[model samples]
Target: MLAAVALAFDMTSVLALMYPGRERVEILGQDGVTYVYACKPGPAGETPAAQAAKAQAAFEENATKFGEAFAAELMQGIEAGAPTLGMALDMTRKTDGWAGAITAHLEKTYGCALLG
Candidate 1:
């Protein structure tokens, strides 16, 4: 199924991103799903602030595309069922809910009380 393929791809991508020196980070969403990723070290001579900025930039770049793709896949799954239009609309509203959950998890894990 497409969902299975997507999950497989996600797992493989996570594994491919991992390296010996990379930091292993696990973020548990309120939805009960856990996202695992390996954060790579910043480039040589880069300041901590610069590294954080770069990480944020990279996260935003990939998150948008991944979110869109996931939304489309979820819509496809809904369409395959006999859901009503109202149900579809409700589901669409939650397309970006995962982002909030992830952000919460990250903030809590990193002790970033000021994260928005």
Candidate 2:
């Protein structure tokens, strides 16, 4: 249920971020999920306010795209591995092994942090 909701939000973000005339983008994963964030390099004389606004727009756009793709990809993987991974995580949590392993897995694999 929670995963579904999160996935929806991510998808929505992606739609919102898909803007025209944007460039210089890269994607990354933090904990266990992939993400897309935008970065731009330009003239040095741009004012702070303008730079902030540009960065904010770019970041938001990148975030939206990243979230949508991440959710879609996650759903595909979860469909394939949920039964085993879910069980493992639950049992590991009960045994205090879930934290490090899960966090590390997400960080190394997806670059997304466990929200929680």
Candidate 3:
């Protein structure tokens, strides 16, 4: 995704998207592979990443949630201030309630309200 139009969040070396012009956040977790949270308008208001993921089969074996076609777009759409891979190394470790913990961290740390 383009750096000027997206927000990236992550936990445990995993990166997630809260793309620009979209009303939802997709938070992938190492604990169970993926943890998604979408806001109002639901599917109709999905981000490019979310739409791309839905375009493919759910949980395609040996393939990413978003197939190869979306890889480049996703890569290019990241916001300029989005966290880098290096930051993940120093990010919070996995906990029992990883989803909640990471969500809290994202909102509190980045001031980006995932739920809003």
Best by lDDT: 1
- For TM-score, candidate 2 versus 3, the one ahead is 2
Q: In model 1, where do residues sit more than 4 Å from their true spots?
A: 1-41, 82-116
lDDT digits (tens) for residues 9-76 of candidate 1: 44535453434444554544344555444444344654434443444544555567767876786777
lDDT of 2 by residue, 32-61 (tens): 443332222235654433433444444445
Better of 2 and 3 by lDDT: 2
Show how many residue pairs clash in every candidate, following the order shown: 0, 15, 6
Model 2 compared with the native: what TM-score? Answer: 0.35
| RMSD (CA, Å), each prediction | 12.3, 14.4, 17.9
Best candidate (score: TM-score): 1
lDDT for each candidate structure: 0.50, 0.44, 0.40
Ranking of all candidate structures by their TM-score, best first? 1, 2, 3
Error of 2 at 17 (Å): 31
lDDT of 2: 0.44
Report how far off residue 110 is in candidate 2 (Å). 26
